[model samples]
Target: MIINGVSVGPYQLGWRLQELEEKISISGFVEEELDKHYTITTNTLKFWVEKEQGEITQITVFGEYEGKFLGKIGVGNRLSDLNDLDIKWIKEDYVYKLPDYPGICFELEDIDDWDELLAPIEFISIYCS
Candidate 1:
């Protein structure tokens, strides 16, 4: 998905906060000082800004962009939703990590106490180190 004209991907690693603001218009952010980070939340996505080097390191898409979510998966989609993608996923409990795609992770939320049923996606995180 595209955030402020820059797509949410590894290429966003070196993007400055102002540059992003220029593109998406920074309304406000929850400032985090420990690591010079900031979280900008929009109606559709959450941007995690890392300022150690004055750049954005990660982005979490909360819902569909335009008409697709991660190429078909949406916020409430379950693990089975990813069946169409030709990705080899590594599962650890409810979290799925893609080995082929660095800085990308999908987490499922266990709404019920039972873990037998498929869980809906809580969030999708894309990072750049």
Candidate 2:
């Protein structure tokens, strides 16, 4: 998977829900509609799409997703891994965002130890700002 500021793989922000359904079908994944969003799942990946006015506003990926964020970061990567990039992460609750990449956030594993550099990323989210 390829995740950027605006998209996760082929799932771009602002895409219609119908477009997602078609892509999901073509990818051979299963989609389940929750009260507020749709969950897409496969053997190795799980993600959710939240839509407003029929267009996707957010995409979150978690649970064994074996893809990199911007082809560099992903689950299992420690917070320290971003140090070389000189990113000043904006911390909010348990989520961290690169100052320059406002549309993407990484959720770390331990909420109680949010500042631990060794903390591995648990998931990633992309959204429209």
Question: Global CA lDDT of candidate 1, please?
Answer: 0.62
Per-residue lDDT value at 84 in model 1: 49
Query: What is the lDDT, from 0 to 100, of the residue 33 in candidate 2?
Result: 86
Off by over 4 Å in 2: 1-3, 26-36, 41-52, 111-115
Q: What is the lDDT, from 0 to 100, of the residue 52 in candidate 1?
A: 73
User: What would the per-residue lDDT of candidate 2 be over residues 1-129, giving only the tens digit for each residue?
Assistant: 645457777678877767776877755777788888777776544555664466777677777777787677888887788886666687888678887777888888876756668878887887777
Worst ten in a row by lDDT for model 1? 2-11
Angstrom error at residue 51, model 2:
5.2
Backbone clashes, candidate 2 = 0
Candidate with best TM-score:
2
Model 1 stretches with alpha carbons more than 4 Å out: 2-6, 9-11, 26-34, 63-70, 84-86, 92-94
